[model samples]
Target: MISMRHVVFMNVAEELSFSKASQLLFISQPAISKHIQLLEEQYQTKLFERKGLHIELTTAGKLLYERLQAVKEIEHKTEFDISVLHDAIQAKGNLKLGASTTVALYILPKVLSTFHSQYQQIDISVLNRNSESVKEALLAKQINLGIIEENSKVNQIQYTPFITDKVIAVCSSKSKLLKKKNYSIQDLPHLPIALREVGSGTLAVLKRALAKHKINFAQLNVKVRLGGTEALKNFLLESDSLGFLPKISIAKELKAGELKEVFIDGLALQRQFFFIERKGETSDLNKGFIKMAKSIYNL
Candidate 1:
């Protein structure tokens, strides 16, 4: 079994902030300091250097952190193994997961809830970010798994198809852009549009669809680039700016008539969402989670 001190230290190393690590671990700053001090004493080396608000790990600290990361993974796997040996139907352990904005808001809740119901003793935490952030979390080993809109081509990560979605062009009922029965991609150059930021799955699909219509995004009259789907939806509701978003992400708003899907000729944007993880690492917990996700999505 790994010590709590080691776990706490790993959290601190990952967060690079004592306060943030303490908050995440539900401990106080002083307690975090004590853990760090204990770890340093055991290693007989300084683990971190403090400079203003930022902290940097010493060489020894970096080495220790890398080992501790593997220790944490082994510790988690051992616990799950014990539970299985005991025939616990609900596989109980910590599951750290990340998801892009669209998947987090639309797809994950139902799937995670169902998994939790069967494994009531398991603790799950999810971080919501864009696809790039999700990829970062996986590479850092900060999250054990991730669900992302397929946008990147990172060679170190393995991606499996989780689900697919369609991008819908939407506008406020008050927006004049909806007046056109069939707007072509060429017509998009004339309207001010709101868009998801680069590296987002929605943006990736939209870019490809535009290329098919021979329209360069550089020429479009973009009003703003929003970070997340919710931000884009809120902006769309309050302004005349046309936006493209996942159809699943705006079901409620569209049902209530807060927004309407605008039709575009020669455009039917579809993209897959992928479950991603570091290549060559596997565990029963990770496999279980993937199985649950696949079953939930009926894939």
Candidate 2:
């Protein structure tokens, strides 16, 4: 097990405030300070530098944090492995999972339910964010595994294909644009488009697809940028502005005549969802979950 001092230090590093760390860890502020002070004394060096009201981890502190994270990961793995040895049929442990908004909202629910039914002993927690944030969480050791839509290869991360998702341009069913069965690529720049935020995997795929057709994203008139799939869908429903979204996400809306897919001639937008993890960091529990998800999704 990791030391309490290390745990306090991690919370402080992440929160950047002793008071916040205290609240998060359910401890007193003075105790949090004492733990840090003891850790600094044992290391014989300053772990953090105070910048006015804020504190930043020093170089040594950053190194220590990384080492502690590795230690914690190993410890968790060891506990899980030992548990499995004693109870081969029912693995018992906690799994921290991160997933991008699309995968978290659309893909993971049913799979997670099935996983929970089969392995009720294993506790599962999910962190939902965009693909970029999910990657960051995985790198920071905040999550053991991630499901993301972006396939841009990161050298420090390993990725495997999880599933294929299609993105399509859509507008409110009441929009005048629905009169046309198909639109020319040139019509895209003239339409007011609502797109996902910069870090989104949907936007990444859209940009790549646009670039493939020799069109620049800046050429399109973007009226609004949304942070989530649902928000964009809602925006589309309230206005005539065009938005691109995952086909799976708007299935119910499409069937209900709330949104209609608009096809652009000579344009096909598709991206693959990926199972991502820090390179060389796969654990047995991670593999087990991955196998189960793949079986559930038939990927």
Number of clashes recorded per candidate = 0, 0
What TM-score should be assigned to candidate 2? 0.94
lDDT of 1: 0.88
Instruction: RMSD for all candidates, in order, please.
Output: 2.5, 1.7
For candidate 1, lDDT tens digit of each residue in 16-115?
9999999999999999999999989998999999888799999999999998888878788788878977876756688899999998988999989988
Q: lDDT of each model, Cα atoms only?
A: 0.88, 0.91
Give me the displacement of residue 166 in model 1, in angstroms: 0.4
Regions of model 1 farther than 4 Å from truth: 15-42, 50-55
TM-score for every candidate vs. truth?
Answer: 0.89, 0.94
Misplaced by over 4 Å in model 2 are 88-90
* Model 1 / residue 268 / CA error / Å: 1.9
Colliding residue pairs in candidate 1: none
